[model samples]
Target: MFEKKVNIYNVFELRCKTTCYFGVGAIDKMRDISEYLSKRGMKKVIVVTDPVAYKVTGAWDVVTKYFNQFGIEYVLYDKVTPNPTVEQIDEATKLGKEFGAQVVFGIGGGSPIDTAKSVAVLLEYEGKTGAELYEGKFTPEKAKPIIAINTTHGTGTEVDRFAVASILEKEYKPAIAYDCIYPLFSIDDPQLMVTLPYKQTLYTTIDALNHITEASTTLARNPYSILLAKETVRLIATYLPQALSNPNDLNARYWLLYASAIAGISFDNGLLHFTHALEHPLSAVKPDLAHGLGLAMLLPAVVKEIYPFVAEILAEVYEPIVPGLEGKPGEAEKIAKGIEDWLFNMGITEKLESVGFNEGHVEKLTELAMTTPSLGLLLSVAPIKAEKEVIARIYRNSLKRM
Candidate 1:
């Protein structure tokens, strides 16, 4: 552990311009709120969501009914995929244009919300298709305002201006961007989340935990973000399972839900460290694995990669979650071991191989990981750049969990 006083560079970047209103009962209060949209000068809106959202929360119906009753025309493009691609963004964006969508009301989990963010930027800058936008020179031209409605309690992706989508050239390779990173509105309604499947409930919790881990432990050192990162994990350790087992524990759901929004804020503050960077390639190659699954698989390994600079802080913050993890001999090692051991009890399959990756696939997964936008995340932590070889090793490590 490189231990004297540590110095971390605080590069402050705040990307979310969209105001978020969070509450357990916000949706109910939001009825007949077309005046708000009218004040924003929005004539029409586009909703990016999946079918499950329709069944789980009646969010789709509520939005449709409200807008219809208010005479605000809107269209729905429910074709967004779990790991959305350039095609989906285009389809939704096109639909938005067809309907003269002035506002994009993205519903559901990260997927639809993220798709809406991408489409808003694409439609605003009509000069490029999803693929074209990813070309050598990518810049957002014109984008309509976006209203994000979160249904899942994880990956605050909807909380920021970032949109992570797969490109055509590299099918699973991630293409993340900060251009046109502004949302007009973002909403977190927990009622919509009460119906998320149990597996997803756990999956998304891990995802939120990873956001904090990376932000606090990654290569970049920002003092302000470290606590935000730590708090994200702490809240999860305290609340995720309560929500998982009880399902309707409003207090548990609300706290974990708060953790999600705060973690989103932390990740958006610019330091989205290595776990995300590492998970990107794993997911591109194995789309069967949920984003949260890939993240859960990679996080413990990534914690091992955490720089000794912040090891003590990381371990102390994480101790409560890993039984007997605090002040142990080789605390960092113990922490990582605790994570693996705990995950095993939870019945989560961390190995990519268990999730269907072969030993032979490592090279490509690592190759693509090196190019992910957040790859710099690796450089900041462990003071290791995860150059091609290192990235390949991380991929292999994740492929067959240790």
Candidate 2:
């Protein structure tokens, strides 16, 4: 146990890149959004969104009203799907290019926002393809302006500089983080999130939870990450269940959205490690898997491995859900079990096997984790050295119910 009296004696850098408008009426900022773009001579826009969430949330109606009032021209690419692909980004980029789009608006959760970020970057470089961009063949210096109109309680994509897209052919889900992809403006209106279905509400919030859990303990973590991660956990722990029970609880939705945005900022500053690093392979191998559910499945196994290295910090933050966790070396197993139980109680009861993965798939998952473009960097920053054996073991451990 290393819980000592804490003191702030070190200095670290923090980055808060996006100008975010959050609250009940935050979407009304669309008027200011139009002005922001008009002021910058960005009239034509490409909107990236899923087919359903944007329309049902009424975000599209509100945004288009402002666009029409401001005399802004826009094209909608509403075909973005979950686990957006390189092909999808390229498709959207082509549409943007053809439409002479000057601004990109991502109008859903991670999938759309991430696709928008990728599209924004691809639009800047005339001939660049999503394959080349994800392959790390080019480092983009700048991108067309991106505006994030986030409509989910998860995916701090609105506030972060990272984007994920899959190369379905190769089963690779590589993430790109460029300062240029940071959204110029963001809206986090919880009103837009009230209609989020039960499973989505659960999965998305879990995604936010996983972000901070890994960010706080990664090698890149500092006081800023820890501080924000703690608050993120507190808010999620306090509010997620209420939103789960009553899908229309605006107060619960508000705090959860706030937690998600800050969680994005936490990871933006602290970076992420095991859970995210490993989950990408799971979702890449099985594109139907929601990223958060994959991460939820892997979290306990990852915590078991990482707890010893940062026991006091893990115990401090995780205490809200798993009370009585102690900062001790041998307690990793207990912490992992406690967390598994917590997740089960939260209705995340599916195991890897239940989701169609078996022992045979572990080898492929392990290979992908080690060889994926940016994943090795995540592994290097993990609290534990995630060797091939360690990665395989985590996957195997997650294949069964606790």
Candidate 3:
């Protein structure tokens, strides 16, 4: 048993903006969603999705079937790719504006859902570009309502208020968090997630784990964050391996999806620090690198450095997967190594070197992290102060596993 640290004196608030429908057969809620849109006179919807996931997961059939039945008019923007770019959001927004879209429906994982959040904002603030949105030039108070149809068990984008996008010209990736961007409705049906490829299954699960790890220990952490983080890690530890071994195991998928949602809500309130802030720069520099893979590579180094500041909370949060890590003040190195070895055994074996990053790239990556619009905010909440040297060291240590 482990004690979850909570300070009663700290002021904190918990809120969830999205109305989420979750479970094994939750995809059928699409019909109810369509009817609600119809009643609200939000019949013109633009769907943002990746080309592959929607069709392969049978979400396309279910969504379209309901849209047709409800007399909903929709346009498809299926070109969203991983690490979605400003160009993608602008293109989707243009199409939506032209089609007189009243609602934004994002289907698939983080990229498409995040793109939909940007598109929703852009459509409401007509004439604004994705670059401008991500650059923080506009502080949007409201946007067209978004409906997130999640097809993956990771990326709590379906239930959170944060969105990320890349500005390729400057090689910058930044995130935006707004009260208005939370999905008006969300559907998390594990049945739709059954077809997730093996690598994605692992990568997305890592992403959720990182979310809780950072959220539970950030300066903004509260009772809500710590409580949810513990449950999130326990669920992932138990269900992820089962889901990996039996892809069609709906029970495993359901719990993983549930975990992802709570993790998203946890971070929505508690916020994140090193892993997410640093990973953004890596993925920005190497667009092909999956976001979760970048975080996994950097996580151990981050844990090793910040463990002293957040030892008790993180130890409790990770105890489910990496046991007996509590109350060891001088065991940061051991704890980090344990996490690295566990992730490796779970199938994430490549290091920064495998992605072509080296000592030469560390300076550039650090600069990007410091200057990226909203990344600095995330860095500010880290338990350890992230000076250039500290940031550079983490990158260097991650070059190859210790």
- In candidate 1, what are the lDDT values of residues 1-402, reduced to their tens digit? 121131211112123566665666556434435667876577587878886785568676677666766678778788877877788888888888888888887888888888888888877776678766644257675577777778888878666766677664564445455646556666667777888888888888878887777666555546666777767777787777688778877667766777887787776663665677777776666666699888877766666655344666677667657755544435656677678777766657667777877778777666666665445544555445656666666666666556
**lDDT of each prediction vs. the true structure?**
0.69, 0.89, 0.90
Candidate 1 segments whose C-alpha is farther than 4 A from its true place: 1-16, 323-330, 372-383
Per-residue alpha-carbon lDDT of candidate 2 for residues 176-258, written as tens digits (9 for 90 to 100): 89999999889888889989989899999999999999899988999999999888888888889999999988878888988
- Candidate 2 clash pair list: none
Q: Residue 138 error for model 3, in Å? A: 0.9
Q: Where in model 2 is the C-alpha error above 4 Å? A: 1-15
Q: Give one digit per residue, the lDDT tens place, for model 3 in 74-117.
A: 99999999999999999999999999999999999999999999
| Model 3 ranges off by over 4 Å | 1-15
Instruction: Estimate the Cα RMSD of every predicted model relative to the unseen true structure.
Output: 6.5, 5.3, 5.1
lDDT-wise, the better of 1 and 3 is 3
Question: TM-scores of all models?
Answer: 0.88, 0.96, 0.95
- Mark the 10 consecutive residues where model 1 has the least summed lDDT: 3-12
- lDDT (Cα, 0-100) at 10 in candidate 1: 18
Using lDDT as the measure, what is the rank order of every candidate, best first?
3, 2, 1
* lDDT of candidate model 3 versus the reference: 0.90
